[model samples]
Target: MNNMRISPAVISKLCCLPAFYFFMFCSLAAYGDDSALNIELKLLQVLNLDAENDQQKMLGISSIRFLPSADPSKGNLILLSDDTGAVENAYGIFETPHTFDVAIECNNHVDGEVCQYEENYTRDDLHYPPLFTEAGLNQDQIDSNNLWCSMFYVGSFFIDSSPVCESDIEGIELLSGGQERLVMEEQVVGFTFSTPAVLHLDAQNFVTHKYTFPFSIFGFKRNWSNQNTQKTGVRPNGGFEGIALLPGEEGLYAAVTEFPLMQDAHLNRFVLFSLEESGNRMEDKVMIREHYSYNVDKVLPEGAAVVKPGYPKTGVSDILAVHNKRRSFITIERTAIRYINRSISSVNKLFLINLPDSSDQFSSSELPTMSVIKKEIPIDSDVMNNYNIEGLTWGPELAGGNKTLIMVNDNDAGRASQLTKIFIFEVVNL
Candidate 1:
């Protein structure tokens, strides 16, 4: 049994904070100092969901993917956020600021209707650069890549508000922006096909045009009202989390953090769902569950830091590894990172489970397999106790390619969170 004890001071510390209430309304953002930290290993940016401004309180980051362009820096970084719940639902381009502008998804001030767009946006006067650069592209290419093909996908979480419910695909281009051109028309096919409510958009575009079945797949499904739902819904919950889009498929496999700070539960989960060709309702979504045990006294008598031989090992000193060599999907639970004192730190031990043939345990039809490539993370400290692990990306498979694994944490939008760190590692023979 886990001890659910908390000192009165810790309780008071949480109750007195207004940000805690704000978290109920918005997802927690990744809080870190603006001053660059010298991350000697792989680095991942934390999206502070509670951020009050683009430069501050980094709110939930909707997407993070590499833009395979000739110039890596110019248009290589693609990042977006709803921007503090302002302008109904607004999206802005990161990596470049001069050409950035906001796209409205809904007008909250409107009366009687919910989650409906009082207006829309376009690229003709796109009002922003690197904004919808692919606008006016071949419809066939858009369909093949599962790109939104429009300036933006807008609609409500409620079903009856629009003709095409759950409409969220917004296209982008160098096209300019204007109200007459945008709000004047709506995608009739979108509204006609699904409920105006419950539509969602992708956070980042995959390098390729479609989905691929790389391994045994597991997806998440939940009440549309849940936070995870909101994050992936027409609106989103925020973070630089990972989602894989495979070849020739419209479905997305998204990995989400299942635990939060101060929570006693240790079980973490991820979900998978498919979007229609029209980018509407998730067609056959599923849930993937993984339970991690951190009972230090019982499981690690020699301490979690002591590794058993024959497990994956590396000469990388200054990092922790014990039974780190294993094959399975990996998730970092911040709640599992523990602190022994200000100077000494202890982290939750990482665990693994074999993949089952059927995904029947999940709510959806897709089942993930054990055939995954496990890369030991470069968490220098025992990654057993902290609660903010929020980022994950697979390394390149071939030699001379990037075989790096990285993870970052959410600081819970507080000064205490400024200590959040990103850890990097490489995969070798296990």
Candidate 2:
């Protein structure tokens, strides 16, 4: 006798609001399939960060992140930029973003609304040559691809105090996890960018130090792990383009080869790195942990008309590890196809990667191609217009459950045809 009778008025109201009674009327609504990876995005707002007008701040943006704040409204946003100016590696930290224009959706995704950042600190080449050269990095290597950052936080808490991007911390430290170089053979070899630069900023955003927290070759410096890339290596400027801190795992991080190691050109390799400290914090090291493989898709579907003969230029640009989940991540696979005199066509799609729960779950022998990674395209090309999207991060949360996924594009060192852009959208299950 749990008899709860609903009045006609109540029933009428519930009927009028289908969404309000969705769970109660499950039989009438389409059920969700857990097997399928389904993610939906609703465009909420878009803005630009150029109100400050610094070319390095506006031009070659790579990744964006929020330095933790205790108060819901006080968090600071930091944007990493490439060495487009050849002056120094730079990034900007700003207060909450407020100014913007109205956003409009295009054929693929929403585009619009100019927003600017109220900068609190602009850190660039504060201590360039020393920080980089300590790990044997040269000037050219330091400037190429630096300062694409992804904060390692678990629900406002830092994974560890290694860099102090947390609420109660005083200083800020970030990794230049953008593209590095890969070399083959020996001395007559090409440049090898197997290291991620470390930039330390004091409380007021003044540069304190700069250096490389290096990754290696056969567990040695300047080598890009045991991938033995010496046979056939990553394309120029195509090494370690994507990086993320593994959620729930402290001091453990992940980086992926921008394109596949030339050996498995069709499959991208994801490598794990862990931080180990010595007596001195500056001398701490990031070493290789594990390796997993993922299959890459064509720039366009099989039957789509393409004007290119080779794979062209395609690879993962940046990675964002899902905060609540242990081993899942958001992978941005992008490609640029240029015609001699035709418009350059691009493919930028977002994929969901759920790595195996345990390292022992699968062996390399099992992978004819070591492409055992579980992947599904949650946001397909059909839903987004083609743009050379380089980076993404979790913006402010909208309803505690839904999050704002902010993505940015690189303007190729300020090219006329390519305008630096930022895109914001409401993401579910992200």
Candidate 3:
């Protein structure tokens, strides 16, 4: 039943290591934990993956996590991909070990056999016939027409793309030939893990279960788009941005929305969903156990000279649960801007919030927002010149009370040659 694959080296190590050593091995692999209790991250080093300046359309890796490695210097990094829309029915997958290639792979060019990189991006696949007539699309049509669900985009026939999406009689499109296709706004919403996991430089141990959330969140407030409906939810490009698995609870996860929902403009909404495996992947429903709102600090950063300054540009990027501690996490808040041709960020900061267990769903109750009261931890722009820091996670442990912390820049904006930067920090005072 556990049909996952791993390298022989890992198999050898796991086979010979004592039972407690198994836990030790797992300890070496950070479970994205840190209580965020009075901890400080000291700058150690910065590595530019695009030193050759080659990454192009494929360079935007929104989030990242490190594969387990004994040698911290040589581990392969797992970079999550372009943040948008639902993909497929994948579940009961990661257990023994799963291998995935991460980041930009340059098939187009190379130097001395080591592939140089270029990422090709396109958004022309939004038209689908199956979505129009309850026709049910083929796998290719389903995959090609990545379903978009943010408030800004809506579909003609609705289909399974959005909760607000229902059959619109007049909205169907009849092509010149006999065929018909559905018309939808080109811009898609929702976030799914995209690509690049180096199998050679990696040891595999990842998510034990696949996760799925409400399609409504993607195309929230889509009733405005629907011929006759108005269900307000997510903002444009602001669907589920982060996922943190609860420590003690099975299948329980904290799903973080990037910005405030249309109804909850004052704070960011965090919804808790419980996933249960079933015979049908499509039938794999997420139970909304509870939700909460976190009051965000929109105040701009205090620096000598800020690069990009936009009030509406601020939002939460990612969240990570502290190890061994339930309901504890550190959230990444970013205030970004466009400087010249590059998409630079003026602010990068972290706030610690310990969420409580068992809360009323945000929409159902009139509850006060939970403010992040911990002292602000700002990753100095001077020290970290490369901006747009979207992802952060605990790395391999270090000597003494100090631990290794790794943060990755999205290279979210700018041209193809934008440098992909990964920051290393010495986390002290744990």
Candidate 4:
């Protein structure tokens, strides 16, 4: 429960009048389905409260994906706090999250603050328990295929002290009976990312250690400063949304969302690193010196609309980047899917970039780019109405080896909107 408090001003920028509310209504509708991994987005759940204990009403869910240390079918669901503040430092303020490990035993089982919506509930009274329901999907519906996957949360949170150091206090605890443990807590160790990114891994089947980074070593680095680092260093133009451990390689790779909040004029970037197990703990993960960056404005110049990045590009920010096994480094843009050709045996590096305009909005038109593929997946207009597309993960493969794309939207915790419309798309060869 690393609660990072945000400023009221920043919170204002993230809020939309009717756009946000529309998305919230659509999101709850998408999650209400009981079965069928339908491409059509439906509300999975909803939260409504207006009383003293409202904070406990709905443990806002952020991202959902399979964890390595558990059954392939069951994954871990993470939620962020509703308080308006920076996400990285929010854990320091309100440290409790309503988290649930998606398991067979917990299927559709309602308990605690999450019961059917009562007419007495309203947002005015600042109620306690929120209302929620299990994902409309069931085991049989999603059991048609066998595959491995994991997802990480990467977003901006106005932070104060240090997220690493303060995560261990009793305040921060996983809500689902502590399924997601507090692996490491530390102060800012050194800013490894221009954008905030979380490392997620699928330990093949089940994993023992769910926490992947060196939180302890980082926490001990007392000199690290969150404010100074963000101002001076490379703050991600697009937030770090996509994360994946490249097979045959050492560490992990992630996609950075769009630049400068929604419009970055610099280079589109992606980070690479290796995760090494140190004496029974996760630590010493080094970032690849040679990273990958592309120009987006140069590619899609057809009046690129205001939108966040998506899977390998989405998350809270825009860019969610990841590699498809031995293929290429896939970078999701606001309008297209761009890939850099790199053989598995080749030294880990970006392959090409022949461009001119270097501004954050500079698209790649004249250069001999690697490979840019446009996506055919139809977006849920309701979810993308206010915030940009946020969550993106290479979904589980089907029974016939065809690949599917699993995407989610950022509810900004429960502050902005809530839509459990996890998009499912089958990749068709272009």
TM-scores for all candidates?
Answer: 0.34, 0.62, 0.57, 0.40
Model 1 sits at a Cα RMSD from the real structure of 18.3
Instruction: Compose the digit string of candidate 3's lDDT tens values, residues 1-430.
Output: 3223344356335433332221211011121234223454555555566433222222445665544345443243455544222221122111111112333221122343222212322212122122232245555654344322222222222335422211111011111211222111112322121110110111222112222344444332333344544445555555555556666665566656677665565677766666566674334445567667766656443444445534436677777666655676767777655554344445665665666544434434222544322323333334443376767766655434355666777654333335667666666655
Clashes of 3: 19
Scored by lDDT, model 1 comes in at 0.25
Highest TM-score scorer: 2
Which scores higher on TM-score, 1 or 2?
A: 2
Tens-digit lDDT track of model 2 for 1-430: 3323444355334333332221211011111214433355655444554535553345555555554344332234555544322222233332111112112222232233322344344554322112323234355544432221122110011122211111101011134322121101111012333233333343333333323333232211334445665544444455555557776686666666676654554677776666565665356454556668876656543344555555457777778788776787888888777654455677676777777666543223222434367665334432234566777777654434466677777665354345556676766633
What order do you get sorting by lDDT, best first? Answer: 2, 3, 4, 1
Going through the candidates in the order shown, the clash numbers are: 78, 9, 19, 89
Off by over 4 Å in 2: 1-37, 52-57, 84-126, 129-233, 278-284, 301-311, 361-371, 381-384, 399-401
> Which candidate would rank higher by lDDT, 2 or 4?
2
lDDT of candidate 3? 0.43
Worst 10 residues of 4 by lDDT: 343-352
Better of 2 and 4 by TM-score: 2
Which runs of model 1 end up more than 4 angstroms from their true locations? 1-242, 245-272, 277-328, 336-354, 359-387, 395-402, 414-421
